[model samples]
Target: MNVPTEHLLILSAILFAIGMGGFLLRRNMIVVLMSIELMLNAANLAFLAGARQHSAQAGHWVAEGPVMVTFVIAVAAVEAAVGLALVIAFYRRKQTVSLDRLSPTGATSKAN
Candidate 1:
């Protein structure tokens, strides 16, 4: 059984679309983060497909592209950690993580 490069490109596009939809529709910060990660992976897939179709030496580097992806993943991990920590702290004071409830103007009150 042989598959075509165009099929791979189509699959990548579909995955990217689904990821984008998930990112936009979900309100929970954690789910949104996962969706964003999915989108990144979809982009990586497309990058590799293009690299292969063009017979570019850079395509071979596509397999190595995960090193950069790993760095981004690490940054995302740190971001999630800090963001969740902030969320917890905010919830402790405000009791909600909903975006609508978060306000920069006088939303936080100093605990005496």
Candidate 2:
């Protein structure tokens, strides 16, 4: 079954907005990473919708959308891996995942 391009685009927008909100409003590093993933997924949906619309115009489904999304998925996987590693390291050093508590250099400054 074919779905309308507008509907798909609207859904993508909503997903992106929700992800953005989560990314901005959440303090936990893991939740922020998940929010980033959500945003990426939203982008993938938009790409698929565009490809589907183009395919509909040409009277045939195209492979470009899925191909591009596959690459994106790979990149997102790598991103998630790296992000999780960083979060784990931060937790190990600080014992907390709160962004406000985690310093940039993981060092504590002492005033003399």
Candidate 3:
């Protein structure tokens, strides 16, 4: 049975919202990275949903959606690598992964 496109879109929206909330509310570097990944996956879901809907119309194919998802996955992999590397470096220097502890100017906040 084919699922409705609206359902897929709604699921994607919920996933994206959850990811956004996690990314914004979490302080740990790892959780933040995971949240970013979650957001990417949600976007991938949305792309696939759109493609499915398009392909259902008059035998029209939508190849770009999967291609875009592939690109997104590749970029996400690179982002994870670089972000983890930075996290490692920061952890080595500060021994903590709290976002509030790391200043944008690379200065460490005073420990409370």
Candidate 4:
């Protein structure tokens, strides 16, 4: 059972597109952040597949790739933490998570 590189590329492209769509369409900050993470993972998958297809893939350690992925995951985690904190504070002040209710000036109605 052999898989072609083209198939992997196509799959990666599709995953990236779906992730982008999710990021664009979602209003929830958490969901949007997750979509961004998905897009990054899709790109990482494509990079690894391409590396596998190449004859002279640098570095003997597979851990290198995973380390980079781990870094990305850490970044995503930090982003999620910060974003969720902001969302929580916003909800506390405004009583809503809807993006439409958020104001740029941080002035929320007290009548929630």
Candidate 3 residue lDDT tens string, 7-100: 9999999999999999999999999999999999999999999888888884988898999999999999999999999999999989988887
With candidate 4 superimposed using the best TM-score fit, by how many Å does residue 19's alpha carbon deviate from the native?
1.6
Cα shift from native, residue 103, model 1 (Å)? 3.0
Model 2, range 1-111, lDDT digits (tens) per residue?
A: 667899999999999999999999999999999999999999999999999988989999988999999999999999999999999988887778888886656586242
What is the clash count for each candidate, in the order shown? 0, 0, 0, 0
As a whole number from 0 to 100, the lDDT of residue 51 in candidate 4 is 57
Task: Give each model's whole-structure lDDT.
Answer: 0.69, 0.92, 0.93, 0.75
**Residue by residue across 13-75, what tens digits does model 4's lDDT show?**
998999999988988766877788788878778766665566234545445556666677787
The C-alpha TM-scores of every prediction are 0.62, 0.91, 0.94, 0.74
The Cα RMSD of model 4 versus the native structure comes to 3.2
Model 4 misplaced stretches (Cα beyond 4 Å): 55-64, 109-112
Question: In model 3, where do residues sit more than 4 Å from their true spots?
Answer: 110-112
> What clash pairs does model 1 have?
none
lDDT of 3: 0.93
Tens digits of lDDT, candidate 1, 1-112: 2456788878888888998998888766667667777777777777666656655544444444555556656876787788788778867777766555666674564541
Model 1, C-alpha of 89: deviation from truth (Å): 4.5
- Ordering by TM-score: 3, 2, 4, 1
Scored by lDDT, model 1 comes in at 0.69
Evaluate residue 85 in candidate 2 and report its C-alpha lDDT on the 0 to 100 scale.
100
